[model samples]
Target: MRLDELPLLTVLIVLPLVGAAVVWALPRAARARARTVAVTVSLLELVVAVAAAGAFDTGDAGTHQLLETHPWIPAIGASYAVGVDGVALLLVLLAVVLTPLVLLAADRHQGGTGDRLQHYLALVLVLEAFMVAVFAARDVFLFYVLFEAMLVPVYFLIGAFGGPLGRWAAVKFLVFSLAGGLIMLVAVIALYLQGPGGPQGFLTDNLTGLDLPVVGERLMFLAFFLAFAIKAPMWPVHTWLPDAAQNATAGTSTLLVGVLDKVGTFGMLTLCLPLFPDASRWAAPVIIALAVVSVLYGALLAIGQQDLMRLIAYTSISHFGFIVLGIFAFTSVGVQGSALYMVNHGLSTGALFLVAGFLVARRGSQRIADFGGLQKVTPVLAGTFLVAGLSALSLPGLSTFVSEFLVLVGTFARSRPAAVVAVVGVVLAALYVLITYQRLFTGPVRDELATTRDLSVREVWVVAPLIALMVVFGFYPAPMIDLVREPSLVTLDQVGVPDVPGGTVVDRAADGGTDDGDDEGSTR
Candidate 1:
């Protein structure tokens, strides 16, 4: 690549590190200085991401753009390869967009006169850098490295700044993540052993050639899937999320749930489909069944939650189910819709967290019962919450509704029964979000909460952009579709799914048919 074409990937990864170092070197006494520096760095990263998105060609939707490659471990044939397709670019953009918002949210708690606040700001900046890198890294090892490296900042964020459960929540989060990483490690090693040519080992390039025996592929695929599923926090494995989220401060919860958790779904799309297509095909039914269960289970649990933070946590699991279902469905619309869901979900959910954080700061509690008639005292805040909640529940004209609708439509084209069941999830979501809004915001102001004030100008700034983007993207998603169509096509072929005009539309069981990778929705 020409010097002018130098991959933006390294820039995306490096900018936050530079921001972090600058924050650290600044005098610990300079809390304002550190926050200033961190916010600037995050916004700059956002600009770069937007530029990268502009550079992408919507027409060549499937190709990786702004590519770069350099040999990192010659002996093992591994290289530091990084690039973004439309789907990856969308995720990269979401990470970039949320970083500044996260920093802004963190600023709300920095009002206390303490020098130690600088360290908190610095860690958030460093985490932003790693978050961007995680989405952009094409090399599996590089991806894994960033994945594991990100835990430290968040661990400290929660442990140091969280509520009474800080230490316990942090430890639980790490234990779950580390255990999953080790499982994936073994799979990565096994993949290296099944090298494409000679003993060169498992660089993604080489592994692309060695499809591996079906049995071995299935085993390794499950290993990686297990790790990512936990991160995705799917139904059975999602228990960690509610505790961690509830214990952490709002800013910390925003980043953890908004950007970091997405790493799991990204892995499934970028790694699993290309490396273990056959196994992915073989496990399709079970995965889809699990995804459907998550949708219903999470929604039901979310509806019953008394704590707002935990309610949001359970709701996220439900949202993740939509993304997973889209991926396993294997249709182009399903895959692309899944990717879009990632971005849209980040915006809506992140906004909710920030808004909730504002409430928590005011009332010093997260209990739904602790809030009432917030609409009267804090109408702006209540309105913001309503918008975000509606969007989260996939209200029409919002970004999430478009993606969720497309996902069900795509899945239905292949498996009508599965689509019917998933639609019930939509109704459940509406019930939870609307009822929560009514009970918390519309009722008569309680004596305690009535004293609560509306969001200040600065707090409003923190959430406005996120809510705006949620609406902007909802009505005009065609640009996003054009950008990712090609990549989704490439992934579909990789996973043994044949491409039709919109996506694969199959009439019967996808497994019994020829395994030319057609019938992408085999999981249905």
Candidate 2:
């Protein structure tokens, strides 16, 4: 079959599930074989993702590509529809790319040997399938189903494999996630009730043309936004993250923060703005305010964290603030930057979590004070930590910098005050990362840390892909930017906003001019 004719997305979604089933069906003594099968299957999924990318029409990034559809519930107007826009494609690839690395990282689970290992690997694959499906779902109902279903494997992964606090963390994660899902369910139902009656009512395209009552639209927007914000884990609702991250395995943390949490922002971009344009606009001020608060608040908390995993978790909260900021800025550059940020954050933060996991495994503790002068013994590991930390801080030569710069520049065009305040988070980020590095990797060597070894060959191979992507995308972001541009423009169009010309504010401020008298065309 031709590439476009193939049910490539369905295969991509189902293959991991099939692999999971196979792994579970293996004989009890085939532990090693299970590991091999899991890795091999994950790699195969990655190859499928690449093929999907290869067949994608980059020039037409706004439209969904390689769509597969079938009616599942004609009575309620729902279907098993799947497709990928540029944003969805990139996130789908992120989920596929991270799963194999996470499996490799978790190869030696601290919990069990034979059956437990197989179970853990199987859960990861199942989670991968759900994540891919969440991004690819063309029908809103399908998206919500996949979105809630993803929590199942993650709950098991954390509760079963995480540390002593695992069970509690898992419960907390479930509570928060389920609460969000329930709220979103209300919104989904209300949307359907208000939508044009047809088999396509649940589809995003059909939902976009909806014209709900003014108050109802705002209420629905809140339902969806609250759900996504909790998933995004913004500010006050973000307490579950540090607990979940600290307790879960590094690999679990990687996928949890890197891939799954992104669905929240992805939902915001795909569903919230387009489906409720007026509500989105009405809600932007409050959302942007909370996003800025999350930036500073999360960074401050990261600086105060003693546990490495919690620290990384807090940094993600901070990074997500930037993402939400860009999305709300309602400018093309801001939206595109936010999209790229989703991908780059996955790579950089995934690396950080995995490296920290290695360190914690060696030191038998997550406390920053437990290790001192680790550079003396494990220079390579320290170097890895440093690079990942630099990426977290959006260092000049890393992938994050390009995306973050665009976010700031784009936000500046729309709101100078918000941009300036958000920039403070950058300084705080540097402080947090540097202080953590100094405490953990610098200072005099501790007796306990002296025996710590460098990264294993497997560990090196696992991290190399993430590190390489950081540097590669850092220097050459054109391909990714190109992929995201059209989607960003589409978002702006949906919101009835136009891109504010770059440097308009800067030029005005430099000339000692104000918005009071300048013509709009002159500013453009």
Misplaced by over 4 Å in model 2 are 109-111, 505-524
Score every model by TM-score.
0.94, 0.96
Q: What lDDT tens digits, residue by residue, belong to model 2 across residues 83-120?
A: 99999999999999999998888755442568888999
Query: Which stretches in model 1 have alpha-carbon errors above 4 Å?
Result: 1-4, 108-113, 197-202, 500-524
Candidate 2: pairs in clash = none
Cα lDDT of model 1 by residue, 346-461, tens digit: 89999999899888888878998877888998989999999999999999989999889978987787677777898899999999999999988886789877577788888899
TM-score of 2: 0.96
What lDDT score is found at residue 229 in candidate 1? 93
TM-score, model 1 to reference? 0.94
Model 1 C-alpha RMSD to native: 2.7
Candidate models: Cα lDDT each: 0.82, 0.90
